[model samples]
Target: MRTGVNLAALATIALAFPSASSAQEWGFPGLGNAEFAAITAGGPAPRRDLTGAWDPGQAGIAGGDNYFNARTVPPLTPLGKEMLSRNRPTHGPYTAKVFEGNDPLTTQGDPSGFPRILNYEFRPMRIVQTPKAVLMLYSFNQSWRIIWTDGRALPQDPDPRWFGYSVGRWEDDTTFVVETVGLTERTWLDSGGFPHSEALRVQERYRRASENVIELTVTITDPLVYAKPWISRDRLPLKKLPEETDFLEQIYAASEVTGFKQNIADKARTQ
Candidate 1:
């Protein structure tokens, strides 16, 4: 009877404590479960930090040189079309090579704003993250943007800025979302001469895909220019750069239009 009792005790132990594999297969709910096991054990997945020098990846737009290459011309309102017609990039479809297109960059202006900065400039960028703000330092024109992440509310009537006022928050552990407004109407939206009014609002979603790659998506909303919101379909994959890569200063100090053309052309040839 003692041997029989020993066998029964073994069976009870087997029934009470399932094997790890069996527990996983049966989808058990507890600290030892597959999905919650790590969390319950006081460990969680590491969050990605977007603090590095990055190179812009392939932006597949035919006959275009920058990020706006693939975007179809928005169904512009009358004012929008008129604004577009006035844009004359040096090498764009509408302008002659000798005629410097009205691109504000031709006048050494700040690449006007976000989409423009991303599209026109091919140099590497560095991101610096802190508790209160994130700073994006561009190699182009030595420009920098400050994205406040300190839980401060966006200003209701902010003074217009060349780069716009930006606020950011983490959407998930891997994704960061930024909203920008109060941009000066003087700047163009892209090197292709897309126009935006002071009423424009830009939404940017940045996701760190891996240690080496980051993906960005931008959506532009301007009731005055387009019939609807314009969200870019292109996934801008930014590849990580070496730690030793230098972001040299790009100063536009040429005073004459001829000097500007010569300087820009020389720089383009090297790139």
Candidate 2:
């Protein structure tokens, strides 16, 4: 069993069960800030290659807003504010009561979806570069997404999807960029319950800083929601892991949550 609670665990109501090989470790064995720095200091990065197992360490886990360290969340429009006011999230500074939360992923076991997948519970993931697409396999919820890289244009008037449609390109020798659209508005922007419109567009920039490190930045732009675009993740460093590294299975099933609530969480409401 885990010793302490973290924001991601609380927000998702999920537990990570490590592989038998990693039973001795406390949490997923991610590098610390100093350790990541030391390990990533080597030679130049390769060109047009992002295939590796990556761990963001403690820096990827956000207690509140994931954008710009919560220092600069752009002001929301009137409609955006109204929509956000209706959401009852269980984590962050403005969290509601546990029973009052309406988070889709936590309470109903809906797919985390799009930016939410990257913003909250951001765990160790594996990136596989294929000839046609770049596939991202996330340890959290055991989910995966594909970003097409075969020079196709974004779909027009496409049906919205949970993960959305993404296309990627090499911006430079060291930088790879991905653009995503057609996301359903059901998912919150973060654990904070920030709302977005159907017009929401997300851009992800991945820069290979070294042989063992990649810096990622995400930008959110929704004209109907915020007055201006803002950065969600700012230069979050992902340290490379060995090829054979195994990730914990962290699935949050609806039936499991129902049982836990009835047995454990509901007991708290009476107290």
Candidate 3:
């Protein structure tokens, strides 16, 4: 009877303190084995250093200006053109006239998604690198995007998301290529109200130009919206911000404050 009790206690102890390999297989408390593997895999060989706060510089069609004025708008299908005609943007490439147009940003909605998020929103973003993922945190709305670098395939049936699902792979020693899909169609493609269907696929190539600069080339493909795939004319150049700078300011503060004032004015008028 004592031998049986001793054997049971040993079994319990063994289960409680699993081997390292078994622990890895079982994964961390809240994460799964696959996630653990991804997180532990580290980045590609000769990992390119892309850690920094990047500023979206200048204002033009290409540099986060109004999407409509950014060069010539991409050739749109008939449906796409109709959608563009229906959109009224309060902010233009050069100015903002909030009272004259329908600006989604003023509506306190999720305005930054995909290519639009990359556009000039007058906010800085920080890039944080980890073994399993590259995290892009935007100052606007305190938004974040995760670019998974694990050797896992994109989901076969991913749920629609505001920013879409993203998977990234290294192209060379200095460039990282990312592909995204499964985006919701409710958001505009740009501040100028460019439209896209759920079938939109965005491919982004990020090249570390130097220690202080990164260049991004974006390609948009959507058969439902455009007659052909279009590449952005401007190869966006992001300048690294100083390490001491803090990007904690709220970019959407004006919109929220104006909205509250408008509510008060409306109430007074009704009374």
TM-score of each: 0.72, 0.85, 0.70
Candidates, ranked, TM-score: 2, 1, 3
| Candidate 1 RMSD to the real structure | 16.5
Better of 2 and 3 by TM-score: 2
RMSD of each: 16.5, 7.9, 15.5
Number of backbone collisions per candidate: 1, 0, 3
Steric clash pairs (candidate 1): 88-101
Evaluate model 1: give its lDDT: 0.62
lDDT of 2 by residue, 73-151 (tens): 7888999889889988878755877777788888778888889888887888989999999999999888999999999
lDDT of each: 0.62, 0.77, 0.62
Candidate 3, which segments miss by more than 4 Å at Cα? 1-47, 60-66, 93-100, 253-271
For candidate 1, which ten residues in a row score worst on lDDT? Answer: 33-42
Highest TM-score scorer: 2
> Which portions of model 1 show Cα errors greater than 4 Å?
1-48, 57-71, 108-111, 254-258, 261-271
For residues 216-258, could you state the per-residue lDDT of candidate 3 as single tens digits? 8778888888888887534666645433345545545556746
